[model samples]
Target: MLEAIYSHLARRAAMYLWMLVVFVAFGRYFTLTINVSDSLPGTVFLVQKGAKPGKGDLAAFRYNGGGPYERGSLFLKRVAGMSGATVTSHDVGYGYRDYFVDGEFVGRAKPLSKAGKPLKPGPVGLIPEGHYYMAAPNPDSLDSRYALVGWVRDSQIVGRGIRIF
Candidate 1:
């Protein structure tokens, strides 16, 4: 009886070991990489080597709040302008749909403040090196297009949007 029990236990141990090996191999082949948690509720973006974002690349980044990031507050925006791209805002007087980038006009950006005013003095200036400017599809979204968030460095970017589905 003792010999039988030992054999059974050994078989179970070997089975577990085999399962572990299979899991490791599967993980190596199908790597599941996720960067943001509840703090950043956005899609998982894949990092592309030597890839430069143009006007419409979705950028995922961590929101650097004064303290720890609060759930549902942080966001990931799409790349509107790349490094060295100039930005400007125009005051339309009535509603204020004014914004420009890289000496070329883009669009208007509504302020997050109560004033509902766009960034003052028109031209917001050029996007710095190793940094990418971003904006959200949601008009109410607080993004780098505003002065508060500003330009984000490349390192801050967790990844780029690959597939939405």
Candidate 2:
């Protein structure tokens, strides 16, 4: 009888350990993001691992280089132009650069930073394969309009941002 009790306890312990392993795996692969930047509205985002972000999808990626912000920082922005798309910028007026993708007007690029410093405009012409142009509806947002956060590569993409609330 004692042998049977020990066997049952051992099986239950093994099942619990397996459950813990699965939970850890899921938590490590997925994350919840609380967006604090005005680039997008404040919301809780559910980020899934390995999700491919297409045009118009809000994505999180690791910033490769440094500029206004720290390097290796995770940035969240909307995918404006995708692979094989054409992105262009033209000075509309007052030093504002307007962006267009595939001949469609996207948004105006802010030439001045929040501190009144000039910002470098993003690249123009065809977006090479495996890269993406990111932007936000807010013109003042520090996004692809500046060279700091230029075309994001697919390999740098972490996951798609899904608004939870």
Candidate 3:
């Protein structure tokens, strides 16, 4: 009876180990991110890097522009405009702005940062190939609305973000 019990335990352990190995091997294509900013709903997310991100997809990317924010820091935002899309913005008064993609109004933008400094407006005109415009759910979010993060290149994309919690 004791031998049978040990044999059962050993088989269970081996199965668990095999499962772990499979997870590790296939999981390399995915990443986990914790949203610390209010740009989107704060939650843990699963990101997949298997394909190119598209407009309306949530994406995780590295910030490559100069600013107080560190380079290579991960930023999560929604893809608002893609290659060949004409992007534009205008002052909407009351310290707020509005953005457009392909002449369709997208969202309102904050004119100033939380520090009270003026935020640079997003780039205007067609987005080049391999470039994307990112936007946040919150109007006050510091995303592609500012020059600091005007457009993201395909090379900077880490993956497509999927909210897990």
Candidate 4:
């Protein structure tokens, strides 16, 4: 009788182990996905193929490369510009706000909007290659808006991520 009881317990333990393995494998393969940050807290969309966000395209980065938030800090920002894209600003010019993209006037017109929203000024030069310009929607978020993390590289991208539960 003791041997019989031991055999039954062993069988039940094996079954439980098998169930655990199946649960873990199923979750990993079927239910696992990536998620993005909730900074804008407004419209959210997926990155479809051919929907490339060029200069001025708001994007999110995988890791911070010694930026304002230190290393490993994630970023969500707009594509202020891109490689070879022109940029201009008045922050260091000691004058009114002025900027242009492809020689066209961008949003840089007024220094401060009526609602106290500062104008989206431009940088004081052309964007370099192998890197993309970026900025944050909210000032509170750590992004290229800060003086630290400037342009991020394409190689730094983990993947065109999406919010998946």
RMSD to the true structure for each prediction, in A, is: 6.5, 4.5, 3.5, 7.9
Q: TM-scores of all models?
A: 0.57, 0.83, 0.83, 0.49
The Cα local distance difference test for each model comes to 0.58, 0.84, 0.84, 0.52
Give the per-residue lDDT digits (tens) of candidate 3, residues 119-146.
7677888999999999887867777777
How many backbone clashes can be found in candidate 4?
A: 2
**What digit string (tens of lDDT, one per residue) describes model 4 on residues 4-123?**
998897979988889999988755533322235444444443432223456655455655544223566545556667788766654435334544545655433334434555544334
lDDT of residue 129 for candidate 1: 81
Model 2 Cα lDDT, one tens digit per residue, 1-165: 999998998879988889999999988888888877777875788888779998889898888776677777778888889999999888888878888888877778776888888888888889999999888877777777778878888999999988887
The digit string of per-residue lDDT tens for model 1 on 58-123 reads: 555655553234533334567878887887766677545566666555545653344444442223
Once fitted onto the true fold, the runs of candidate 3 whose alpha carbons sit more than 4 angstroms away are 1-13
Candidate 1 minimal-lDDT segment of 10 residues: 31-40
What is the Cα-based TM-score of model 4?
Answer: 0.49
- Residue-level lDDT for 12 in candidate 4: 100
